[model samples]
Target: MEDSVFSLIRTKYNTLSPTQKNVADYILSNSEKVILLSIGELAQFCDTSETTVIRFLRKLKYDSYQVFRVKIAQELSGETTDSIYEEIGTDDDIADIKRKVIQLTISSINDLNNLLDEKQLAFFTEAIVSGGKAIFIGVGSSGIIAADAYHKFLRLGIDASFSSDSHIMSIACAHARKQDLVVAFSHSGESRDILESVELAKEGGAKIAAITSYPNSSLSKSSDIVLLSSSRETKYRSDAMISRIIQLVIIDTLYVSTVLKLGSEGIKRLHKSRLAVAKKKT
Candidate 1:
């Protein structure tokens, strides 16, 4: 099934320019009305020009305003899930908290499906499979994700390295070669250290892939490939909480895809690794 227009708008909202955001805000709030209005009328309602509206639609990859409106109309006609962000209340009990967390997590995962481009995912998987070495870098919570990715790749017998320290990351990236792939994780995609390391990797002719929430971020701009995650932050829940889950899922997806592409060789290596780890057990 095609993604809901509302979901797409919310996922790509952070990447929109100010004028584009104005167009998005109007369509989101007035989705039903938007389907009825002409593109020029919608532009007028948002206090923007036809060209601005066209640009906004283009950003969403809508072929034309008519197609964009049809999608909204179709979504409006269907049974829609209310996935709006709800803040956790101080008075909420354990059951309430559990339900809210699970609901939001599920909603965010659904958004990830809607926002992620399959072609980009395939490209990233191919890069990992073909690259001579893989280096993962992130800071803070993102660093934890990088470490997890490194662990997964190691199990698959891929030559991979990960470092949370900025200096170590910089040094590692300095040695990156043309056949290397540097995977950087960041929710905001504006981490200074991550960007610095990415720059070094670029200088050394390494390919950069960013798994981040913001598509318009500096990291995304520098990346040879980008895999986007979608989630909403609330008063109590930070972007890390839900986005971490999504990032891990993305990593797992890539790992599995790489294994599939590697065929029997991949299975044999995975089996050997498992037996080696089992030998360490009591």
Candidate 2:
């Protein structure tokens, strides 16, 4: 597969230096013009030195400015000019805030096309479908995503469990078997409790899958499979908040794929689950 320049930028954005970030910001905001600009011109436009621009390219793992431009040009060849994210200001009206929020949400979700690795996603789906048992763990807002995944899996009649409590998570991990799959959700992927729980799961001989934003995070390091989520933070909106939505979308994708893989049996389980719930309605 070809490299995605924008996805690479977002993946490494948090780790870039201040000057490198400046170059990144300019390239992200003016991608069209960036591909057409010379290295010296881009440095001047970003108010940084040519050395800084070269350093930024290196961070993205491009050997030369020409290669970097070629990748960006390839990515932009079939793309439309859409605002990826916008900062919400105190002076903005409710309508302005609503528009910005929707745009940001759509753009972030679209970025998943580039951010997600299809092979990793297939690994996760197959793990939960055939691994026999699955445990979902997360904290704070990520806990919500874990719980949602647990619910979806349960409706599919998969033996799944979830807990937001660190103590219960630890206990669950301790009991994880080789056939068990442990799915951990953490946007930053650095949550101490999550890392500890994953470590325990690893020791117990379970397959670890991490859904997170940072590829270099500790949790990703320990996992057998990692699914990356794309998000950008602003004054009013944090990466965690934005990543929550993206995480849910990933969960939905997994759920649907699991159902298709399970065939008729999966549909029956879903139908039965819905019927059981409908019996409780007044």
Candidate 3:
């Protein structure tokens, strides 16, 4: 599903131009007043022209400013979740930072647990159990996640590859078959290279699953199923921070589910793999 107008504005604010951001900032900070503010009035408040204000509305996927204001007003009618990380200030002492971090992690994880749809999850799990190769694709921090998935799923006796490099991902997709599974991870779901590879693998007849924060993004659109990850980390630290823990948790869930589906045979595979790794430790 597409995000709400308020969410779209918050998520895309950084991509907006300076003038457009001016309008965004005002609307975000003054949502209640926007319900009564005219186009000219909002423009004056943003210190931008009326035309720019209209463009900002259009950017939010609203055809007009009035519609945009109405959406915000409607959202105001319901309660919204507060950002769990709001209390974690940069200037806090070490102990305070640690406490806030733990508190936020517990709250965000609980929220994510409640938000996940069982039907959507089952679709992806069944795909993995259907006897095909699985390819994991991600970049940067998400690459670490994809790599971790590679280790976990491979232990279940599935044919899996973790491709972090863009070129390698494209190559993997090039060789992907109809039964192959391509799972892409990108928090923004807007990573150009990842999107390109996913699109290619999709065309090549691979079933795709997207794990991301945004459900309506391009990557999600390409996937056969989506596993949404919800996080509330600080803006700059989102990709590399506690969100990664949530993602890992998602992978762990998938791992255990697949193991259960594979049943007794899956345990044997895991034991064998564990023994091989144990030999290395010796």
Compared with the true structure, what per-residue lDDT tens digits does model 1 show for residues 47-113?
Answer: 9999999988888888788988887787778747532445578999989888888877877888887
Q: How well is each residue in 1-282 modelled by candidate 3, as lDDT tens digits?
A: 434555556545545788998787677667778889899998888888999987887776678776677777777776443222244556788897777677656655665644467887898889998888999999998999999998999988889998899999999988888999999999878899899998888788999998887767788888888887765535434533656877888898889888888899999999999988897884
- Residues 1-282, model 2: lDDT tens digits: 654577667657767889998898888778889889999999999999999998898888887999888877877776743324357899999999999888878777877887788999899988998856899999999998999999999999999999999999999999999989999999999999999999998898999999999888898889999998887867798888778999999999889989999999999999999998997999
Candidates in order have lDDT scores of: 0.87, 0.87, 0.78
Structure candidate 2, residue pairs in collision: none
Tell me the spans in candidate 1 whose CA falls farther than 4 Å from its real position: 18-78, 82-85, 89-93
lDDT of 3 at 62: 78
TM-score of each: 0.81, 0.87, 0.70
Candidate 3 versus truth, CA RMSD in Å, comes to: 6.3
The window of 10 residues in a row where model 1 has the poorest summed lDDT is 78-87
Top TM-score hit: 2
Scored by lDDT, model 2 comes in at: 0.87
Error of 3 at 79 (Å): 18
